[model samples]
Target chain A: MSDNQKKLIEMIVGMQSPEAIELTKVMLEEGADPNTILDICRKAMDSVGQKFEAGEYFVPELILAGDMLERISELVKPLLKEGGGGQKKTHGKVLIGTVAGDLHDIGKNIVTFMLDVNGFEVKDIGIDVPVATFIKEIQDFQPAVVGLSGFLTLAYDAMKETVEAIKTAGLRDNMKIMIGGGQVDQVICDYTGADGFGLNAMHAVKFCKEWFGVKE
Target chain B: MNTATQPTSNNELYAERVQRLNDAIALRQPDRVPIIMNSLFWHTRHAGLSFRDAMYDYDGLSAATRKALDELQPDAYVLPHPIMALGPTMDIMGYRQLKWPGHDGVSNDVPFQYLDKEYMKADEYADYIFDPTGFMLHKYLPRIATAFEPLAKLPNFPSLYYTRIIHSTRSFANPDLVNAFQTLQKAGEEMGRMLGKTVQFIDDMAALGYPLAESATALSPYDLFADYFRGSKGIMLDMFMRKDLLLEAMDKAAKLIPLQAIPAAKHSRSKGVFIPLHWPGDGLMSPDQFKTFYWPPLRKVVMTLIENGLTPIMFWEGGCTSRLEHIMDIPPGKCVYFFERTDIFKAKEVLGKLVCLRGNVPGTVMSAGNPDDIKAYCKKLIEVAGKGGGFIMDGGSGIPDESKDENVQAMFDATREYGGYA
Candidate 1:
């Protein structure tokens, strides 16, 4: 890796947004490969994700890092398209939403952004989504994985109903379903009839990666 | 022993329940651990009223609450479920912060939802810090409630003085601003009626031998900004983007919150202030970040309440296991650390000696599991956390609104059966 690329990754990981944005512009001006720069940005995001998993960072850090990545991507996207690279390749398709009776979206939004950056084509159907909406989105998107999110105790009931609806609609076999947010345990997962449960956004990403047979 | 043989008068029972709770708060052993039925809509469910009915019909809400409390007599009650009876008042003012059961297309059975948004824009921090009241009247209120939208057309009221005051009074004559004040008047009347029912409920509960848990409510200054103004996304970015302004705004709130809370607490029946925490849990911010951005202003609010001789019952909503050590820096026996998702055992180990612990029977068990599961959980809670006193038996986030009556009964039964101290 070149010196500027290394500096770029370090700056992004450190949450130095202005410096990272400046260096990205300088690298592009210096005739660096746009794909190479995008690759370094992904590596930085990966490191940020690792720090979060290791408990060294938390939501604020993740949000700051996400904001920085967006700015850098805006800078690099045109160059990549000019080079005929045609945007980053989406590894797999994932459909996610907060289930009925749940209005929380902070956890779901974080998961959506993380999956998007990790090369997954994610469809976020928004909060308080009905079982019919989930079924309709699953048929249209034909996603490899479906994630049900809820932050209330009542959401568990809704989740169980949503998962059962997916089964009744014959969409269960084609996709793996995961449930997340607010006091979810093995008991809840079984109650919801989900294939697995995620404790955080990274866990959700890991579920998608594993299901799609994508190696890190 | 003779007390059990006689029919206890309501006066005697009131004093007994009050003593039990006070002893628990002061880190003293009561006869047994005390149970606080912190359920909001569950009482309505038990009374066969939907949450919509509970929110809209104050008389029905009061009757339902009385019925539930009469059946499951707790040591204390967190009366009138803060927002349950204010549906009409919110509707009058077009309150935009929360979407309730019947008014906003939300299902009648579900709890209210808070809409997190940048009600106060990022660039408006200096304005808020400069004059919070002015900004609140001119900017924040108008933005959040449609009834107050016309208030935005009025000039800054602080600048109006002497000749300016004489001229500024004319702004009030604007038809739109006049309509806004009428709207506020209508909302105030509705609120007065709701509060009348609330006061009546409190009086009835006291007469029937139950005490209200908290006298007044306050918010963490950081939470004030996060929930009502900057929002989760806005405040998270401000930590890095504008630390100084955020700190100043929180400092301002720190000074203002205690002013309202302390006086209200002093005039009320109980000496506790309910502060339901919305942020500053483990996943939202790291320990270091919490120590830096979240704790100082909150500690100020807490300490001020403590200095005023009021107990601050903070209901930590999410898992704040990492921040417990930081929170432990408070005066012993002066506060209650009520938790929702944090491990009760670990909290007891850490804060057992310092402050009273309330809560943490998971809502999942209350809503989904059977009576046996609840009894087992409450038995363990009472056995361990209730070991040397300073523990109050309650649900993780109060009793879940959809909790089964049988499961709730098991909680009360288990506490009485296994929670004896002597």
Candidate 2:
């Protein structure tokens, strides 16, 4: 990475949004490749994840890093697409949402950020989404993995119904289905008929990478 | 007021109920484990009233609650009043987070759903630390409450130093501003009257034979911010990026928040202060995060309540299986943990005779499961959690009205059949 690129990584990981934006503008102005910028930011997220595991970082830091990276992505998307790379959906594709009757989006939002930073093309369907929406999104996105999220147990039935609908709709055979959120366990995963479960955002990332055969 | 399972007098039933609960909390085998019916909102529906009716009519609410309690006859009651069921207030306030009874977006049949939103932004931590009351009035309130949107444009509270008279008089020069202030003035009077009624209802319930389970509830510093100020996603990010600020904010809240409830607690005949813990567990955080962000201040709050001659009953909404080892380090018998999901047998092994233990039954099962299932679940729970003493079997969050009426009766039946000291 160039010095400016390295500094950009530092600012993003450190959660300095104003400086990170300025540095991105400066780099693009000097003809720096947008792909390299995204690559460095991804590495910064990986570091943030590591620190989170080691207890040096926490939820706030993860969120701020996600926010800064998102801001930076907004800044460079036009330039990258003009250079024939912005529309690129690389790494992996995953579609996630909170099940019906469940309006909680915190778990879904965190997973969306984790996957996005790791280069996964994530489509968050938001909260209280009906089962039909999941089937429709799977057809449109054709993602490799499907994640069902809900915070309360009332969504247990919704998760099960959605997973069942996906199967009946013939979308289950092609995708690796996953269930997540606060109340899920091995039993709930089976109850929802999901292929696997994620207890936290980090676990969700690992699950996606392993399923798609992507390495760190 | 005379009923079965009593000595044919209201006074005797009251004394026996208090004595039964006190015995269980002390780890002594009571006549049986006392049951606390936490089905507050359910009574409104069971009474054939729209959830909105309970919101506005205190007399109807009190009568409905009393009738339900008489039928079930649980040893204690939790928030069995209209305060929490009041959805009309949310409608008037234009709270974006709540979908309430009789509201345009939601049906009147179902209980209200409170969706979490990020009311406090990332940068407002400094403002909160500096001047909490002023910041909340002008800065935070306007954001969360849509009806209070005009308050954002009002002058800073301290800046309006014209005189004492101006403080009471809200004189908005512009006609639109005048309209806004009038709306607020009327809402304030109505909300105050509603709150007064709920408080009075609590006192009335105490005057009756039923012992109030919890008169006042406050969150730990972490949850107060997580649930109210920042949503779950917001607080987690704050933990990593603004570690110092998060810790400082928790400490400030821990010191200040409990003081607000002291006067109420001192005057009431409640068992003690109650805490409805929301965050800090269920794999949302790491063990290190639990130690650093959650445990200490919570322990301090428990100790503070105890020092004031008030006990702390912490209802772990989502269980704390992993943190039990650390939680065990607190002075035993000084704490009461009403858990929702930790395995009872495992908790018995870990917290043996330390803190009193209560609950693991999810309200979901009772709402749908057959009476036999309720009996079997309680039988197993009593075998494990009720070995020597210190166990109170309760539904996870609450017993819903949709909960099978037989299964609701079967809870106490199972307790009487299987739960015994000797």
Candidate 3:
């Protein structure tokens, strides 16, 4: 990587928003490949994920880093389209949303952002999503992984209902289903009939990556 | 030596309950480990009241809460007042912070959901710091509540000293501003009625021989800023970008909270100040960030409360395992450290001698698991954390709304069976 590109990654990881955005603009002005720059941003996010897992970083750092990546991607997108490299490759597709009866979306939003930055095509159907909407979106999006998120205990019944609906529709076998957010455990997972459960955003990412057979 | 044998009078029962809780708070063994039922919506549900009815009808709320307390019969119970239900008060003021049941397309059974957003922008810190009262009157209140929107048009009132007072007073005559003031008056009256009901409920519950766990609540200044003004994302970013301004705002809030919390606590039936911690847990912010930004201002508020002889009951909401050591700086036996998800065993080991430990039976068990699950967990909590006293049996985050009726009964039964002291 060029020195500017490396510095851009460092700034992004450090959560220096203006410095990272300015550096991205400078790198683009210097005629760096937009695809290479995007890849470098992903590389920085990988380091950020590692730091978070290692306890060196926390939610604030992750949020700031994600924000920087988003701003940097906005700067790089037009350039990619002009260079005829608009269609990007993703590891796999992941569909995530907060289940019905639960309006909480912070955890789901964080997981969605993490998945997007980690090179997955993430479709966030938004919060308080009905089970029928999930089924409709799944048929249309045809994702490899589906994540159900809810923070309230009442959402356990909602999750079970959704999971059962998914099974009745014969859509369970094709995709790996994972449930998360708010006190999810083996009992909840079994009750919801999800394949597995994740305690945090990184766990959700790891499950998606593992199911897709992608090694980080 | 316990009230289970039937006290001669309700006053004796009340005194016994008070002593039991005080002994636990002082890190001494009472007759038994006091059990407090901290369930919110579960109370309404147990009484067969819809969430909407509980919020709107004060009589229904009081009856429902009374039914639950009479059936459960714990040492202490969180008053199921309409303060949280926001019944008529929500519509009176046009409050914009939360979406509640029976309003704005929400179903009658749903709980109120707080809509978290930055009510105050990043650039408005200077405005807030210079005059928080003026800032609230001018900017913050207007943004959060529609009724106060016209107050934004009124000139800064602090400048209205001499002839300026006459000039400023005229602005209140504006039809819109007049309407706003009248609406505020109605809101105040509604709040008065709600509080009256709450006081009556407390008295009725106390008459029936139950004590309130907390008389008043104080919000951590950091949480006040994070929840109402800056929002979680905005405040988190502020820690990195505008650390000094954030610190200044929190320092200002430290002084403001005790002004209300102390006086309210003094007038109430209990001496505990319930402070529910919204942020500053292990995964949300690093230990260093928590130490630098979150803890100091909070510690200031806590210390002030302790100095005033009121015990501060801090409900640490999330997993704060890393924050255990940092929080031990408080004076011993002067506070209750209630953990929602923190490792209570570790908390007991670290803070047992210093502070009373309450809670951490998983809400998942209370909600989904059977009575056996609750009994075994409570048995273990009573044996371990309840050893030598200073532990109160409670759910990790109170009993969940969907918690099984049998499981809640099991929790109460387990406390009596396993929580006695020699």
Pick by TM-score: 2 or 3, better one: 3
Comparing 2 with 3 on lDDT, the higher-scoring candidate is 3
Candidate 1 residue-wise lDDT, B252-357, digit = tens = 9998999999998998889989998989778889887899888899999999999999999998988988887888789999999999888889999999999999
Full ranking by TM-score: 3, 1, 2
Top candidate by TM-score = 3
Model 1 vs. true fold: TM: 0.96
Which DockQ-derived CAPRI band holds candidate 2?
acceptable
Off by over 4 Å in 1: A26-36, A76-90, B1-7
Q: What's each prediction's TM-score?
A: 0.96, 0.83, 0.97
lDDT of 2 by residue, B1-422 (tens): 22236467777877887777777777777877778877756666678777777765767887888877887777788775534545556666676766666776555554556768788888989888887877787788778767777776665666566685476355357555576677767777767777787777766666677778766766788888888888777787777667898888888888876786566677776756778788756466667778888877777777777777776888786657877777776666766788877666788889868877777665656654678978999888888888777887787666754566788788878877787665
Q: In candidate 3, list every pair of residues with a backbone clash.
A: none
TM-score of chain B of 1: 0.97
Isolated chain A: TM-score per model? 0.88, 0.87, 0.92
What interface RMSD, in Å and to 1 decimal, does model 3 have?
A: 1.3
Q: Measured with DockQ on alpha carbons, how good is candidate 2?
A: 0.27
lDDT of each: 0.88, 0.76, 0.87
- List, residue by residue over A61-135, the lDDT tens digit for candidate 3: 988887787788788888875546433646999999999988888789889988887778999999999999999
DockQ comparison, 1 vs 2, better candidate:
1
